[model samples]
Target: MRKTCLDMVYELAKADDRIVFIGSDLGAGTLSEMQKNMPERFFMEGVSEANIIGMAAGLAMDGFIPYVNTISTFITRRCYEQIAIDLCLHNLPVKLIANGGGLVYAPLGPTHLAIEDIAIMRSLPNMNIVSPSDAEEMKRFMNQSKEIKGPVYIRLAKGGDEIVSDPKNGFKFGESILIKDVGEVLIVSSGITTKEAIYASEELSKEGIKAGVLHMHTIKPFDYKSIIKYSQKVKLIVSVEEHIKNNGLGSAIGDVLNDNCYHKMPKLIKLGIPDQFPDKYGTQEDLLKYYSLDSKSIYESVLGFIKSKGLKAA
Candidate 1:
């Protein structure tokens, strides 16, 4: 996903000189061609991440579409005030290319982990959040970023997942994809967690549980209507993500259920990491297994949760 995003953005920069790229000390090897080609438009600000956003804001004010790239924690958490006051205040079209989103940096410890970035960015007024499931969605979202006139956060991941979305699928900015049979068990997820949900759905099919997977690429301005419709039909709704449960996708869907007046709604289960720092070092896959976010654990947990609720499978 990261390579696809950079490839498309570099292509956009070639035809138009107005596209400026800014990086806060990252991906030096991959961006060598871009830096050599467009030296004037590319800026390599040192470790000062806050200043990078400010510079991007200034460049945007001067008729440049500045795209900032950095680690997830540094981009949102470190320079939030700058984003709010400098960029979002003017509604600048600054594309945020954030890598290592969620718990992708499990071995680096909690400081490098961005478990709450989605929740933090969703609170900003004019921020547009896009969590693409794979490389195909990343390319589509990059094309859509050109049309949007405000701050946009584009979440990226390491590639090599199944292509759940086709290139011919109608692409929109703030839409959701319902990927399988619309049954009584609906699984809503974003980012790489979408892949985990897909695996769990396939496992559930073996038990005669027709699980539905909704890949929510967009977080802010969520498609509440679709969420409520799925919630009504499903006997159980499970939200899976790599982010913290609080203020993440799960909480957002819960709010939609409340507003739509679905008092007797299906049981909603939030699956993700708990609210605590990690004590030991491990790989991303190990952390997932420890958190019970792998395919087998997720499938078993969903079945157990549903059975405990005394709900019949659809």
Candidate 2:
């Protein structure tokens, strides 16, 4: 996903003269072809993440769309003030490509984990957040970022994820895609967790419960319309994400449910990291399973949730 996202930046720069690329202490040969082609527009800065936001803001003021790439923690947690003041305050058109979102860098420990990134960024006005399921969807997000008026943060997962998103359907920044809507059990998910939701749908089908999957790739301008549609159709609604349960995708959906669904509203089972630092080092997949985010765990959790409500299985 990282390569695809950056390559699209390089690709976008080829066409639009106003497009520029800025890196915060990235490695050598990172977008070398882009630098070779458009050296003036490419900037490989050192470890100063906060300074880069001010610089990107300045460039944005100059009518150039800057794409800033760096580790998620450094760019967000470390540079929150600059992001809020420089870019977000002015509503600059800077695309922040945040790498290692969630526990992608689990081996690096808590300092690198971006578990609460969404919650923090969401608080800032004019800041838009998006998490694409895989590389294919990342391409779509990058393509649309050009038109976004304010600062947009694109959360990127580790590359080589399952291609659950179909390119034929394409991708819109603020729209939610409903992969399937069959039974009363609706599984709402975003980012790589959407892959698990897709799998859970199939597994639940065998159990006489035809679960549906609603993929919310864009989180900030959330598709409450889709959530409303499913809220009315399903008896049980389950939301999943790679971030913490609070102030993430689940919380956003919860707000929508509270405001819109009163009578006959489906029970919600929100699954995610339990708002604590990981206890051990492991791969991303291992960490997700440790948090009960694996497909089998999610399937079992949803089934248990359904039964807890005294709802009979189909």
Candidate 3:
């Protein structure tokens, strides 16, 4: 998804002179082509994330759509004040392209893990939070960000996921996509974790437990209607994400369920990173397994929860 977003951005920038790319010590060989094509537009500010964001905001004010690229943790956590005050307060159309979202940077330790970026960024006023499920979704998302009037935060994965959304359908702002049929269990998920949820659902189906999956590509301005309708049909409602339990997709959906007070509401389960920071360093897959966020772990958790409801213990 990050690669796709970068390609799309470079293509758009080449065609449109008003577009520029800004990087915070991430202008590796991956972006060499873009720099070669538009040297004046591409600037690599070494590790000064706050300055980069401020520069993007200023560029936005001048009618240039500045795309700021960096790791999820540094992009949001290190430059919160600049994003909130400079870009958001003035409603600048600065596109924040962040990589290593969720546990994508697990080997780099807790400081690099971006579990809290979504929760924190989504809370800011006039900040549009977008986490497209795949590269195709990201293409549509990047195009749509240009049309939007306020600041937009686009969280991209490390790539290598099969496209689940149709390009012809296009992406609508503040909307959710229903990927599969309705089932007894509804898995409402965002980002790459949505893929994990789908695999877990398929595994559960083989065991005679049909599961429905909803890919929540848009995190902020979530589709509450879809959530409510699905919540009524399923016996279990599980929200899976690559982010922390607090202020993430799970918490957002839970808020809607609680507010509506829908009768016979399905049991809500939040599957994500827990409160504590993991001390050990490993690969993204290792961290997911360690935190019980993998497909097998998710399957077991969901199955165990369902069994617990029936007073069955193995």
Candidate 4:
């Protein structure tokens, strides 16, 4: 997914002279082709994330669309003030390509983990958040980013994830994809977690529990339209995300249901990492399984949540 995003950036730069590439403290040979092709527009600076934000903002003001790449934790947490003030506040056309989002860096411990990046960026107005399901969707999202106004935070998952998104369904920003249509319960998810949601939905169906999956790739402009439409069709709504329960997809969906659904809101259940730092060092999948983010665990949790509401499985 990471490679596809950068490749798309390079492709976009080829046709658009106004496009620029900037990286803060990235490894060697990162986007080397773009650097070789457009040395004047490509920049790779040392570990100053804050300075890069200001630089991107200035470049944007000069009619250049700068795509900034860096570790998720550093770009969002380290230079949050600059991001909020310079990029979002001014509504610059800077694209933030966040590397190793969620537990992708779990082996490096909690310090490198950006489990709350979406929450941090979602708070800022004019900031668009997107977590594509796979590399194919990343390509589609990046193609749209050029025309999308305001700052964009593109959360990248580990490379080589399964491609679950289809071009036929259409990838629209701030829109939701109805993966399996509305059923007894709806599974709303984004990012790589959507893969798990799809898996759990299929498994649940085999056991006579009709489950529907809704993949919300765009988080920030929070697809309130789809959330309300799908939430009304099911008896229970289950939100799954790789982020924490607080200030993440779950919280955002709850706010929507309360404000829009009123008492007509269905029973909503949020599944995600608890509000605690990951102290264990392991692979990304291992950490997710430990936190009950795996397919089996999610299926069980959703099924359990359904039965607990005195509802039938089928």
Give the per-residue lDDT digits (tens) of candidate 3, residues 1-314: 88899888898887788889998888467678888978999888888998998899888899999988899999988889999999989999899999999888877888888889999998998888888889988888877777778888898888787776777657898888777666778888888777888889889888777778888888877788898888888878888888889999999889889987467678889988887776778788888888788889888877887777773321
lDDT tens per residue, model 2, 68-159: 99999898899899999999889999999999999899999999999999989988999999999999999888888899999999999987
Q: Residue pairs in steric clash, candidate 1?
A: none
Q: Give the per-residue Cα lDDT of candidate 1 at 169.
A: 62
Please list the residue runs of candidate 3 whose C-alpha ends up more than 4 Å from where it truly belongs after superposition: 162-170, 310-314
Relative to the unseen true structure, what is the C-alpha lDDT of residue 29 in candidate 4, on a scale of 0 to 100?
87
Worst 10 residues of 4 by lDDT: 305-314
lDDT of 1 by residue, 1-314 (tens): 88888787788899888898888878767677888988998787899989999899988899899888888888989999998888878889999999888877888998988888998998888988889888888888888777788989887766565566767665688888887766879889888778888899998988778899998998977989889888878888889878888888999998998788467688788888788876555877787788777777779878997688776665
lDDT of model 4, residue 67: 98
lDDT of all predictions:
0.84, 0.89, 0.84, 0.91
- What residue pairs are clashing in model 4? none
How well is each residue in 1-314 modelled by candidate 4, as lDDT tens digits? 99899889899999999999999878788889999989998999989999999999999999999999999999999999999999998999999999999999989998899999999999999999999999999998888899988999999998999999989988998898999866788989999999999999999998778888999999989999988988788888888889888899999999999999986788888888889998788899998898888888889987897778777767
Instruction: State TM-scores per candidate.
Output: 0.95, 0.97, 0.93, 0.98
Q: Provide the lowest-lDDT 10-residue window in model 2.
A: 305-314
